[model samples]
Target chain A: MEPAEVEFLAEKEPVTVIPNFSLDKIYLIGGDLGPFNPGLPMEVPLWLAVNLKQRQKCRIVPPEWMDVEKLEEIREQERREDTFTPMPSPHYMELTKLLLNHASDNIPKADEIRTLVKDIWDTRLAKLRLSADRFVREQETYAKLDNLTLMEINTTAAFFTESLNHMYKLRTNLQPSEGAESQEY
Target chain B: MADELELFEQGSDAGSDEVLLTPAELIHQLEEAWLNEKFAPDLLESKSEIVECVIEQLSHMEENLQRAKKGDLKVSIHRMEIDRIRYVLSSYLRSRLLKIEKFFPHVVEKEKLRAKEDPSALSPEEFAFAKEYLENTEMFLKNVTLKHMPPNLQSIDLLKSVPQPNLDSFVFLRVKERQENILIEPETDEQREYTVDLEEGSQHLIRYKTIAPLVTSGAVQLI
Candidate 1:
């Protein structure tokens, strides 16, 4: 399976496209795309919207979730929750990054969105670091890391491996040296 | 030519080469090789050679460690370097092995269909290495099952169950050219053809498998 981040952005997240000219339906591998009419709003995959926007054939309408006030509320709720609060989309971070990078001009309050996203990311990362510290200190073998994003996973994977290796070394020191005995024999 | 001859001579002499590559150089080489393989997997004809060199250096480091452990030498700083090199080498190989395993079925099918010796995507050494790895892993699993697990599980083909890597992986990439009329088969739909316009700096999140050939041909690049 693809990471939830990639899967959500690629498949589920929708972008509103306002085409500059009328067009008949175009067949795609996923499905038929549109009967694009000039100045009328039509929803399409983010990928297609970006492509069309790049070609100067359409202007993209940013999703409602990009709102700074909405994200702030969500961040507060997330901070209060003992478990991970359900996000608007699994790929919220990646989507925000992509849209901000590609279609900033289309989005309202793009700068605010960028700052809010960064704030949310930083808060979530602080929480993740806390959990990681507890995990290492407690020497837990298994963890149910609900709501951990792919980016988060990538960041912590090396740390987890190093901690595990340290634990293994400690365990080995507690036992008789197998290599030493084998070499002697 | 002289440097190449010296390297060959050093390799032949094995332990006699006192001035082997510094740990930093070895680490740099490993990272470079990894990046090279990642970007242009098909161009990795020298991967096995690099792996061999790293292994030899690793063994030499191990020997030094053994001597140090017995108070016969003083090289404690090398310990961290050795561990770092080992980790990098293992990861580099593991990434390559994962790719090889994921594409093994595709490679075999393509070879049979085309009736060719070279599978365009993977080097001959890489293919053989992957095949051997699969066999060894299967044997190891069987041994574990026989020793610890119930006999009922013995019939299961564990090797076959190793899921292919990045089958559904999506990548953010930019099209470098006006690739026209490309055919793509989505996971849940029939094949469809579309013309992609390459207005410079256009990016999309596409299935890596769909654009892998394009990536290899430098028509697109992962961002």
Candidate 2:
């Protein structure tokens, strides 16, 4: 999957936004949103929050986990753990970029949070690479990937899968009678 | 089926106790289907019911919005929601088309092999598209190269020429329902095959062939 597609899916995650303009409860096909009273906070999807922020119609409340203190702790915990640590949000990486890029003013210590998130991302990626190398080197057919998020998986999906395919093809060629490729097709 | 997401409320068929799937839950299912089709190596069974329901929902929302004033904020929010849902709907259909174009022969063959009582893997329109694509491809091959070849070589097996989806490819997925003792086949002869139990909500990286049934049954989801 393309990184943009992962970001697209992330955009659907709900975020809290305080709309400046008052509006009645809007019934959307996916469900309902708003009943907007000016200055009161309500939950809206990230896509809408960004749209409203661009028009200066709302102040996005950076999600609870976007705080610098919380993220610093997360980064520390991530570095300490060999396996992936549970993320504050499933799309934490995408959410940070989206929120920080569009509405930095709403979030406190935006720069610090950005750096912290980048640190956590890099740390997790290194662990992912190490594990992937082990998986390949060991020629393991199955692996439990608990706590790995979609964006994390997508970063190496294409190259990793292609290499595995090539290795499998080469391995299978040695066992010519068991041509698994032609069996199903 | 509605229980698969675990985000829905509440009913089953015990004589007219119809499951009340909210519009939100229906959209969730459509999105799941979209992602599954996108990641899956092979074409999955067509979710025509979900496709039709989503289309109906979108049009119904649009119709309601038609009566509202242009500058109305509610109208704008509704429109934005409509656009978002429409994007998912189109992307879902487009991805299916891409797969069909890649494996037209296999897709059509699967459709034929399906039992009469079973649902088709392709929607009616997609079935037509695959059939036509196959014929056009053969005709093009014949016109361009096959005609000039020896008579004995003129007849070609499209199936042999086309590549099939690699079922052995590893995929990232999350379990929806807990399963016990799923056997994981070894990649090489020296390796011993073993079984692993799947716990609900945990993710895994495994060969597609090992969990193809889980994908179709909605027990596990491709990430």
Off by over 4 Å in 1: A1-12, A169-185, B1-223
lDDT of 1 by residue, B49-168 (tens): 446666776786677567655522123324534555676677667666666665554444443465344323444666677667656755766676545766675554332343323223
Off by over 4 Å in 2: A174-185, B1-19
> A1-185 in candidate 1: lDDT tens per residue?
12442433243357788989787764321234567889999988776666567767788887788887898898888778765666776577877887887888989899988988787777778877787788566544334444555455545554554555456456545334321232110
Which residue window of length 10 is worst by lDDT in model 1 chain B?
Answer: B1-10
- Worst 10-residue lDDT window, candidate 2 chain B: B5-14
As a whole number from 0 to 100, the lDDT of residue B110 in candidate 2 is: 88
DockQ for each candidate? 0.02, 0.52
What TM-score would each prediction reach against the true structure? 0.44, 0.92
Residue-level lDDT of model 2, residues B43-137, one tens digit each, is 99887878887887888778888987898767887888888788888999999999999888889998999887665688999999999999999
- For each candidate, the alpha-carbon lDDT, in order, equals 0.56, 0.86
Best by DockQ: 2
